[model samples]
Every structure is written in C-alpha cells, then in structure tokens.
Target chain A: MKRRDFITATALAAAFGLAGKPVYNVLASKDALASKTGKRLAMVIDLKKFEGNSEMMNKCVDACHSMHNVPDIEGAKEEVKWIWPEPFEHAFLEQNNQFIPENIQNNPILIMCNHCDNPPCVGVCPPKATWKRAEDGVVMMDWHRCIGCRYCMAACPYGSRSFNWRDPRPKIKNITANFPTRSKGVVEKCTFCDERIVKGLEPACVVASKMYEPEAMVFGDLNDDKSNIRKILSENYSIRRKPELSTQPEVYYLI
Target chain B: MLDKIFTGGKKYWAWMIFLSSIIGAGTLAYLHQYEVGLGVTGMGRDVTWAFYISQLTFFVGVAASAVMVVLPYYLHDYKKFGKITILGEFLAIGAVIMCMTFVFVDMGQPLRVVNMFLHPQLTSPMFWDSVSLMGYLVLNIVISRVVLNAERNGVKPPKWIKPVIYTSIPWAVSIHTVTAFLYCGLAARPFWMSAIMAPRFLATAFAAGPALLIIICFVLRKVSKFDVGKDAIQKLAVIAAYAMFANIFFLALEFFTAYYSGMHHHTQHFQLLYVGLEGNSSLVPWMWTSTVLAAISLYILINPNTRKNEKILGFGAIAVFLSIWMDKGMGLIIAGLVPNPLGYVVDYTPTLIELTISAGIFALGALIISALYKSVLTIRRQV
Candidate 1:
C-alpha cells in the first residue's frame, strides 16, 4: 500500500474509534437511510384533459391493455382491467358535493390502484401473497403464492384489484412478450409498469397520453422533489379517492 | 357402534340415499368449478364473496352454539342438560365439518390451503379463524369422546376432562368471534366494521344453534326413543328466547347507528339489506321475511303458555333457525358487497351450481350428525 494512503485510512479509522463508532458505521448508516427512503412512485391524472375526449381515453386504455395482456372479457362480471376510467362522482363518493358541473360530473376519470403508502390490500393478505414493495411502493402480487382468496379485493376501497374469474390467456389477442400474463384463480392489478420502469422506460399510458397537445398524465418517483409529478401535484389543486380512510393514496387527480 | 349408523329403518336409509344423491350431484358441479374457475359461480368482480362464505359464517355460528348447552350444564352443574350436552357436542362436530367443507369449496385454489398454516401470520384474521375453528373442532371431539365413553361406563369423567370441557366453553366463543373478525377487520367494508359485530354474531349463533338442537331432539325422541327430556327442551327454549331478544336488540342498534349517523357507507349497507338501493333489491324480500319471522318467533318464545306446548314450541324453534339462517346465511355476506367500494350497486345471486354445492355441504353435516347420534345411542344402551 502507498504510505500516504495507508496513513490517511488509519487516521480516519482512529478518529472513528476515538468517537466510539466503527469506521463502517458511516457507510452502514448511509445505506440504511437510502433503503428507508426508497423511491415512492406516483401518478397524476389531469381530469380536465379527459373531458369529452372519449377517443383519447380509449387510446390510453388500449395501450395499457395491449402492453399488459389484460383480457377483454365479454361481460362486466367477468371483465378484467389493469387501468380503467370511473365516473368522477363515483370515484370520489365521499365528496358528495352537489355543485360539480354537469359535464365534469359525468366525465370518466381514469382510476387504478392508488398504491398507497399504507395499503389495505397488503395489510389484509394472509399469505403475504400481495405486498407493497419496500423499494417502489408498488402493491405487488405473487400469483404462485396467492390462494385466490380475494380478501385483497374486499380490502381495497378503491376497487383497484381484479380477480381472474376464468382463464385469461385464450381471450388475449396479442400477448406482450416482455410482461408475463397471469393465470386463472389469482388476483391481479396495476403493477405500476414495474417491468418497463426497470428498463428505464415510462409507463405505457403515460407515453400514450403525450400524443395529445395537453398531456393527461404524469408518472414519476414521488420521493424525488424535483420530478414533474411532484411539481405538478404541488402546483395544482388535486383530489384522491377515499382519502379519509387514511391510506395516504399516492395517485392524485387534478380537476 | 359402527353398525348402528348402517342399521337404520327404511325411512332413515331412504333419507341417507337422498342426501347422498344430492352430494353426488354437488361433487360433479364442484369438479366443473375446479376445472374451470369460480367463473361458473354467480359471484363476480364486484360481489366477490357470496354463497360459500355466507354458509361458512352460518355453520361457524352453529359450531359455536354447542357451548350454549355446554356452559349451562357444565358450569351451572345443571343435571337436566347432561344428556342433551352430548347431542350439542355431536352437532358442533357436524357443523365444523360443514364449515371446513364450505371454506374448501369456496377457495379458488383449495390445493394451496396448507400454505395458510405453513406461513401462519397471527395478524391475519383468516389465519386465526382457521386456528380457532380447528382448535374448537379438536376440543369438541376430545371432550365429547372422553365424556361419552365415561357415561357409557357409568362412571365419573377423568379430572383432566373437566378442564378441557371448561376450555371448550370459551373456545366456542372464540371461534365465532374470530369468524366475525374476518369480516369486521376489513376497514374497506363499513357494514362489518362495527364493534357490535362480534356480539351480534354470538347472539345469532346461540339462538340458531339451540333452535336447531330443539328440532333435532324432537325428531330423535320420536324415531330413536332417545329423549333428551321435557325439562331440557323447556330450558333450551328459554335460552333461545333470551338470545333472540338480544339478537333483535343488536339489529336495532345497527339500524339506529347507520341511519342516524347519516354516513353513506354505513346507511347504504342497511338500505341494501332492508329496502331497494337504486331499484336493484334482490335481497330485500329475504331480509324482510327474516326480520318478521324473528319477531314472531320472539313472541312465541316469550309466552310461557305457548313455549310449553310442543307443537307451538317446534314452530317457534323452526322459525328462529330459519330467521337466523337468512340473516347470516344470506344477508350478512351480500349486504356488505351491494354498494361496493365504488358505491355502485351490484347484486349477487347464487347460481344452481353454487346452491347445489352449498346443499351438498349442508347434507354432509346432517349425515355426520345422524351417524354420530346413532352411535351415541347404541353405545350408551350397550354399556
């Protein structure tokens, strides 16, 4: 070892030793903090952008479904969805205000798993089959581990999760090669484009929404103060579904 | 004892054959469900849990109701209840079997049930529900077997058996409470979130369980000369009356809190249960019939003059059982889901396959009860 480098390292170790802390303690603390403050991804939906724009909404829906291989079942009872639109008033029933404009009240606002910091789905899962990821705040489902008990469905106040009522493979016209399709007898939901995110690509719906002049959605790590989602969330007046339940929903809807 | 179950009268054999046929059909339907998924059932995306879960809730109550007899006989040292307590224990065994079967059939992946135990989590109500149920089942089995054997020999039960019997009394209460916890813990379901859920479950369980036993006892006396005695029947009637009253009072409280608070989450559930919500009221008639029947049963039970007459008493008992069956068996599970999380009304109607599967499970329990009673009578007579 070089004499100068060896002496400097020894000196730093001695300083830490004198302070009754190990030299690795500093590195360990940084790593521990980093894990504790991992990325919390969130989505911001601009409701105004979807007003009377059924064609644009359909495009966004198609992109997400085709990419995810979500089946297009015939009836509402057997329907499966990763992301879908809901009526504005129905989406936020707790805010039973009478004065929402007629057009806005009836307009369909996109809804999916809020991916809450304190998710009820994760809390109710008996086998730990469904859990909120520590690194990304995505409510993940392990289909193999799941017993398809549907307790997660009951626990979700937003109706975000869907159970595979039948085999979904036959109904999928085109399968997304990168993403794995789910089997029957399992519960599933929006995984926040987990595969795409790892590849350093934005969610499909977010990319699709950019085709129009006014972008309808923004997706980013909520932990990043400099990210566009955080900035948009702070600047605009927004609402979340069933916030009184104290799930601390990450998804924001700008009306 | 082994031959006793097989060596029944022609009518008994005919009844067994009838149940066996239904169970056979249900087994076929279940196979279809297993090959396909829960899609064949009437349950859907919105009302996810329906008939099977409702039956589980009802049978769990029936399983726990055995304690009503056990507590009075063992704790109070009431001698009249000694003979009837065995019937209660046997009924518990039957009910618990039904409970387990309902759960198994309801499961989307029944094969993965072992995972529940292998990865047991104390925090999960479903885990504790299984724990309490299995625990109660084993307790009842051990207690009933040991005590019945001692009775057969015309001797005192072992000292250890006393503690086990005592444990079962509270264990009975725990099974129903844990079952209620399965529903009440879900913060997303406002209808089941009240603290009164456990008490209401217990009250209904006590009423329904003993009411069923009364009917069973009447049948056993006529057919098998196995009378649990006139005084025992009267005592059970009184117990059921009080429980039914408590059950009614709790229902009233549920109504008052939900309607008076004016919370849509709370009121909307009751609206679905009692009246039509948004003109889609499939369960309205059933819920009203149950309520009216309960009130009528309460009247008959409360009147000592009517309660003493065997025919009148039988009618009251049957009414109470049916009333509670409707309440827990249909209303409890369905009402929670009607105005679903999105505040949209979606009704769940059990399909023929679902109904058949449920009937099969019910029949299986009755068969177990019949066999166990036959064995009990034979062994006791022989000894």
Candidate 2:
C-alpha cells in the first residue's frame, strides 16, 4: 500500500513538470515560438499585375517608407530610397535581351535589397559591422561600428547599401520619432521591418499587398509545408533577378 | 644667373615659397570639407570611392616605386644611382604622407581617424594597410636621415643603418602591395576580385611611380639647374617601361578571361566599360582615352629614337603615368559597381565638399614633399 502511494506521487510530479504549466505561460511561449518555426520567408511577385499598375508600386512604396521612415527629398532622383519603382528594361537589362516591348510604359519592379543567402556585403565588411542573421537570414547593419570606409559599398554588387552623406533623420517625418535614426558616415539598407516582424506584424510592404488584386504580394516561411510562399513556389514559375551572380536572391517575380 | 641661384641664397626662399603654396591650397580645401562635409563632393552611393582614393592609390605606388631605386643603390651597390638615391627616398616620404592624408580626408569623420586603431579589426586589409604604412614611414625616415648625414660628412653611413636601409627595400614594396591587397582581397567586387590584382598593382606602381619620379627629376633640372643625369633617368625609364608592359599584359589577360569565358556576371563590367552596356557609356570615353594614351606612351618608351629626346621622353612618361593612374586608380575600381545586384543602374558623382577635401589633402602632401626636398637640397648644398 505504501509503495503504491509513492508511485502515485511521482507520477503526479512528472505530469506537472513535463506537460502541465500555467495557461498564460504556455500561451506566451507558443507566441514566442510562432515566429521561428521554419517559416522560410519568401515572396512571389507577379510581373503581369505590374504591367499597367504603376499606382500599385507607388502604394507599396508609400506604405514601406512611411513605416520605415524613408524620407522624401524634393528631387526624387537624388533621394535615398529603400524601395522605388524602375522601368522594366532598365530593371532587367541583362535578361530582356531581344524581347523589346512596343510600349515600355509599365514599371517592372520596385526592387530593393535582395537579402541574398550568400551576401557579398556581409563577407566584405572588415569590422563585422554588417551581418546576415542566421534566424531569418536578413542582412542587418550596425551604424555605430561602421567606419565609412566604403569597402562594403564596393563589395556589394546589389547597390543595396546607401551611405548617409548627410544626416537622414531630420528629413524623415514624425514617424522616426518612434524608430531609430541612422547617423552619418555609415551604410544603411532594408531590414525587412525587423521591429514589426518581432511584434508579430508582417513587413509593411507585404502588408500593403492588397494594392494589387490579380496577383498580390505573398510572404510566408519557405520551410513550412503550409506557408503560402512555399505553396506558391511549388505552384508557380518565377524568376529571380541576376541569378547568374549566384547570390541566391530571396526576391522573386512571377509573370 | 641660374648657376648663381642654384649655388646661393635665392634658391632657399624659392623652394620654401613653392612648397608653401601647394600646402596652403590643400589646407584651405581641407577646412572647407570640415565645415560642409563629404556632401560637397560628387561621390554618390554607387561610386562610393572617387578622385581621393584614386590619388591615394597612385601615390601609394609612387611611394613603393622608391624600392626600385633603393634596391639597386643599396643592395646591388649601383653607384650610378648613388647621388639620387636620397632624392628617391625623400620623394617616397612625400608620396606616403600624401597618400595617408588623402585617405584621411576621404573619411566622413577625420576626427574619428584614430578610431580605426581603438577598435581594430584584424580581418580587414585596411587595418594591415594602416600598420604597414606606419612601419614604412618610420623606417624611411630613419634610413633617409642616416644616409643623408653620411653623404654630408663624405663618409660611409653607420653600419647599423645599412641593415635598416636594406630592410626598407622590401618594406617599400609591401606598402603598395598591402594597398593592392586592400582591393584584391575583397571577393565581391568583380573588378578587384582577381588573383592578378596584386601583381597588376605592383606593375602599375613600378611603371607610374618611377615615371613620375623621372618627370620630377627633369622638372628640378630645368627649374633649379640640378642634373639627376641622363644615364640614371634612362635606366629608370627602362624599369618603368618593363613594368608598363606587364601592366598592359595583365589588363589584356583580364579582358580575355572575362570575355572568352562568356560568363554574364563577369562580362557585364567589361561590357559596361567598353561597349556602353545599356546606353550608360559615360566611362567609355574615359577608358578609350586611357587606352590610347597608354599605347602611345608604350610605343615611345620602347622605341630608341623618340625615347632619346628629353622633351619626347618627359611627355611620354607623363602620359603613361596619367593613363595608368586613370585605368588602375579610378575607372577600374570605381565603375565596377554598375547595374547593381538588383539590376539598377545607379550613378555616383563626387560632390564639391569631397573635391575640396581631396585638393586640400593633395596640397598637404605637396607641402610635405617640398619641405623634405628643401631640407635635402639645403643640406646637400652645404656639403
């Protein structure tokens, strides 16, 4: 009878320790894990929709810059942009060899940082000031550590990194009040809205996907079987810009 | 009148005046850069490096080219270069000073130049470059002083100084080699990412640097009635010619490899430079100009007739020097980043702030060179 009582006590302890926790605690842990689970984030951009919808690209740009604190300069050509629209021919000069379109009015893409798997910028940084995160493979910059040598600027084939020749923070609207501002003498690039991602919000550009209806932007973990991005990759044919560079760019487009 | 001035008092003031003007201009430019910032320069995001770096690169080669003179004069005991060995060494000192200042002015924050030391990154070629440059400066000063003092006394230099001077020969080569390694080691930039980069840098350094020295010697001969001698110059020009030959060969090899392989990524940069890839032919004119100048200079140097004339030879050397400077220092490295990874053609232009700062730094270098040369000339006159 004593042995049976000891066995029952041990079983209860094991059950509580291994499988049973407070409901709130369990929910919080699950929420924390929801971000990391093999959701290889990928994009499937439909080029066909971009054929006539210049406004769609502009809307996406507005949403991204507003959240990311991208300043709008008077001369748009001189502006430092995280994402901006480019004509199809200029955007795909290497690939569009002979397929000269009669009417090239349609904007091809609003390309920004590719966030390549084999990022040349990260490889070239002398001070480890820039790095590619293993968690999500997003390349990030540490402004304080940068010496403004511009070697990484030479190293990056993507032309993704922008040096703050002047202080960019002042030109930014009140939006930068909450977000951190970059100082002069360092490189800056797109971070996929890391702050929003941490808070369970999608990238601002991805959230603004509704701007295009026929084939809106879709972002999901590439690793997860149920993620929308993985599903699209399997279902559709897409092309990555400058694949010959072997940078393995994460951004893709679908026609 | 020329002989009197060369042998007497007026020469001292003239040297000082010439040097001070060059240095003064540089200081003024630097001040403007400090007030406004790099925004004044044309340097943009795409072409992050510009004229400042190009000058720095050319000067580094000039600094290292002293090795050619030093090696033969010191190691081989080539008495023919004995009189001018000290001159080459002093010139190197000026070149290095200019090179260092150019890099400093090019920085966004000149105040934070020391930060490179405070937070050192061993992986960076720049860190190694900094260390090597400092080492070279210290060594050059010590060796130059010891030799100059001995020359003044009409006796052999201190036995200890011989080893140090000998050591500087290789150290001279290292200064520029490390500078070249700075670019070549980087794997991402296609123009710089080649095993041949270091060799090419050395070749260009030997050619352009020596050629520059020859021109300077000729200038001194004309202005101050100092003769470095035709024989010495002819030997130096031959060295420059051989180096130029190698530089051209390596460039051709790079062209062949990039084009013959037909790799799109590698070929794109070459196409951009020569063929006006996608209607952005801004660099084409510059590239062609460099090529034509280089060819003409090469022909002049290789031929016996034209090479014999000081006027023709001086012009040839200057042209070759400028062409190589354009090819290696500016166009090759800066224009490498076109049609960026996202396939966007971004243009980079240096602003006025950058230009002023660069000019100021260059002046600073000229000032140093002038001061050094003045001291050497003054001391030699006394002896």
Candidate 3:
C-alpha cells in the first residue's frame, strides 16, 4: 500500500513540476519504514575478480558517469570527478603489509567515495552541504548549498570530492547525455548511484558486476543476518582499508 | 581624513599615484578572473589551492600579530608600545582586508560566500574558520575605532570597550589556531595532521608578524617622520628572535618524527621539500634558500648589537618574514597535498593570472595602510 502511494505521489509530483518535494516525500516514508524494520544499506567487494577486471571497472565508470552527468576535462584544475578506479597498490598502499599475493600486484581496484560510517568530510563541512543519508548511508552533496570553498575536498581522505573548475554540462557526451550537469564552482562525489538505488535497482556498477569475476562484487543490507553480505562477513577474512584511521568505511575487500 | 589627505602636497600625491597604479592593475587582474572563472588561475586538481591561499595564510598571520603589540600596550600599560600600538592596529586592519580579498578570489563562486551562513556546518573546520575570521574582523574594526576615538578626544575609551579589547586578546590567538586546524585536522594528509600545528602556527605568526612590524616601523621613520623609537625596535626584535627560535624548534621536531619513524607515506612530503620525491625537485632550491635565510636572520635577530644596527636589523626582518612566508604559506599547503592521497604525483605552478591577482591584493593592503597612516599622522602630530 505504501509503495502504491509512493508511485502515485511520484507520478503526480513529476507531472506538476513539484520535483523538489519528492525527495522529502520519499525520505519521510523511508523514516517511517526504518522505525519498524531498522535496515541499513552496505556493500562488500571481492578482491579476487576486481583486482584485474579493467573491462568491468571501465563499464561501471561509464554507467556511473552517464547517470550522474560528470564531465571529463584533462586540463581543468578543478575537474569534476564522480567515479574512477585506482591501481591496487595506490588504493591500498597503507594496507599492503608484505603478506599480499604477487598475482594481484599493481592491479586496479575500483574505488569511489567510501561512504564512511564516520565521514570526516561530513563532520568538517560548516554549511552541511555534504551529508550522509540515515536511510541508505550514501554520502551526498547539495551543490546549491555548497559555497565552492572546496573544504570538503581538502578534508576527504580519499580525495573523492571533485571541484567544478569549469562549466561541466556542455562537455558531457551523448553517452552521459541524460546526466545532470553540475555548474562551475561546486564540490561533487559519488552517491553510490543513488538515482538507480532509489528505483529499486542495484547501483550502476553493481548491475555491471557480471563483467568482472563473481568473487569481485557483493552488495546487500549489512543489518540483515539473512543478507549475502552478512553471510560473507561471518565466513571470510574481510578487511577494510586504513582500519587504524577508524573511518569504518562501508566498502570491504577480501584479498 | 579629507583635510589631511589634501595637506600632503606634491610628494604625497606622487606616492599615492604610484600605490594606486599597482592597486589598479591588481583590480584589473581580479576582474579578468571573475569573467573567465578560476580556470585562469594556475591551480590544478592535485594542487587545488595555490598562491592565493598561501598569501592569505601569510596575511592572516600578519593580522594576528597585532595582538602582541595591543596586549602589551593596553593590558599591561607598556608605555614603550604607546607610540607604535596604533600603527600595529592599522596595519592589522589592512592585512585583514587583504586576507579576506585573497580568500574571495580563491573561491570558485565568490558570490556564494553568503551560503556559508545560510547553511553552516558546525563540524567543518571551514565553518569555524568563517566564524572566527568574521569575529576577528568585527573585533579589530571596533577596537581600532574605539581606541582611535579615545586618542582623538584626548581621553581614555569608555569602560565598556575594555572588556571587548581584552576578549580580543584570546580571540586573536584563536584566529590562527583555527587556520592551522584547517590543515592539521585532515586525517588523510599526514604531513598536515600533526598535533604541533597550532603551536607552530602561533610561533610563526609571532615571528613573521614582528619582523614585518620592524620593517614597517623603519619605513615610517624614513617616509612619514614617525618615531617608533630604537628601544622599542630592539625589544620587538628580541621578541621576534624568540618566536623564530620556537618556530624552527617545532619544525625540527616534525623532521625528526618523519625521518626517524620512516613511515613511507609520512616521509614522502618531507622528502619532496628538501630532496624532491620521485626526482621532481623544483621546490628543493626554494626550500633550501628559505631555510638558510631564516637561520642567518635568526642569528642576526638574536644578537643585540646586530639587531640595534639599522642595516642588519632591516635585512634580518626581511629575511625572516620572507622565509616564514615561504615555509608556512607555500611549502606547508602544497607539500601537504603532494603524492595525492592516491599515491600519484601532482605538481602545481601559479600562472600569470594567479600571480597578478595576488600582487594586486598585497598592493591593495599597502594602499589602505598608506592612506590611513597619512591621516593618523596629521591627527597625532608625530606622537
């Protein structure tokens, strides 16, 4: 019944150009569900397949960038970066403590914003332009409210937040044609493909998970014992990067 | 102020024209940036912030330095600072304006500065930074106005302004503390996350601020016929010498930890400055030159005989100020951002547009100081 009401409200709001009111409508309903079920969203990535699947990483990047309307400029100082993969050695440099296997040496690790449990960027933002949603734990940026100070970019440990140095809307191609182009002078980061997750679909990258090894991808409710992620966590020797930093990053890796 | 301005004759107009031209050029450069966006600046993704922020940091230190003079003069009734405290206050006012302007240009959307308050985040250091900066600005303006009013009327200020003045003493310290936290609080940037950051900032602020005061006092004596007194100059130099000692000491401690512990991520930035990480060493020469100049300047400042000698004192003041400016403003921010957290190398060089706008902001500060000095001289009659 609640789902039926959401569909009706969403259809009406879109028809009447009450676009801004829909987020509140969805959030209010989510809060109601949370009070009863107490569920939280999370992901667990298998390192085995993700270590070498460049094709999978690229596919996911394309899908994420297209959906978010991120721009590609090689020379702009304040480039807008939504998602990108980094070499494994660089991504987990601190955690590479002499025990890792040689087969995975220098392989790429698909990374976006970690969506930390204790997000430093959220804590340091003076205007609360950046926030972690209590419902799904996706760290989000409100570009309209961001003052272009780039403080969040500085505070982010992963350098996930990208600043818009130039108008990014025009640069996006037809592949990313439908994405919302950000204006010049605001900070942006990965939202774990919230637009898709909201539609009862997996993240864009998760949907493209088949391009990589089956061991390379996992996403589910961390709070549910019946969830696949919980089963994997209880069985495998899973690890998160820079555990010493205590950021409690939601993304986990099984090496 | 208008009457005195007209009284300065041909020499004053000539000086005003010279200062105005520099400021005019700077303003033109600033407008160009506004039209084209921040793309005109040399900053890039890796070194996202460049000269403007460095200059802003240096000017903030300069603005905070006025507290040293103010505390001694007002709270302790140190008559030695009587002839000079007003100059410090006015210099601070100018520095604050420049600091604010530099920050403005560095912003991607200067118009959005209002967004800071409409949706402020208490958790972000930047939120605190904005609050502290605004608080200090209001405090400096109010104190300067009240103190000048008392000075003009030939009477002490009303009792109400005293508590505010005293409050600013601690508030002055807080400005630099918050600025340092802007860097040190970042968990990923290891080079910046040191606990010594706030203390180091205070030390450098004291060191560089007094050195600048020494030079300004000399310039005033030559150009405006202001008597800052040899005794006060010597005393301030001693203060600068101690501050420099503390600054260097803190730096040395940082070095010991980075090198001794030998954490690869931690040592990479330190190596970038002194020896160049990954064979890129452009900053190496600048860093070494700054260190050498600072050490020599400290030696000169520490010696009573050398400090009292106007020529040596002048050199020492300029050297110390420049060294601290390079170390804190340029090296600190850039080095912290290096070896991008992703373990990639990112280098930055300021472009012509960035340099011009920066120069213009500095010139703007000097222009205000020159005009204010002329007005105050006319009113005070050379103290």
Q: Which parts of model 2 have CA positions greater than 4 angstroms off?
A: A1-53, A74-77, A100-107, A210-215, A220-228, B1-15, B149-167, B181-194, B222-226, B258-289, B308-311, B338-355
- Residue-level lDDT of model 2, residues B152-249, one tens digit each, is 67898889987898789888878878888877765456666788887888899999988888898887776555678898988888888899999999
**Interface RMSD (C-alpha) of each candidate?**
1.1, 3.0, 1.8
Compose the digit string of candidate 3's lDDT tens values, residues B1-383.
42555567687889778878887888888888787767787776767777888887788888888888988888989899987787787788888898889889988878888877887777677778768877888887787778777888899888899899888889889989998888898887899999999999999999999899999998888876688898889878988999999999999999999889988878999889999988777688888988998989988998878888989999999999999988987788888888887787777888887888888888789878877778788888762
* Whole-model lDDT per candidate: 0.87, 0.74, 0.81
Clashing pairs in 3: A123-B123, A124-B124, A125-B124, A126-B120, A126-B121, A127-B119, A127-B120, A127-B121
- The worst-scoring run of ten residues by lDDT in candidate 1 chain A lies at A27-36
> Top lDDT: which candidate number?
1
Task: Indicate the TM-score of model 2.
Answer: 0.81
Q: Please report, as a residue range, the 10-residue window in candidate 3 chain A with the lowest summed lDDT.
A: A30-39
lDDT of 1 by residue, A1-255 (tens): 999999999999988788766546655653111233889888899988888888788888899999999999998798999889888777888885889788788888888888887787886777878887888887787888888888889889899888898899999999988878888888988888888888889888888888873558888887788988888988989988887787878789888
True contacts kept of 1: 0.65
lDDT, model 1, position B356:
86
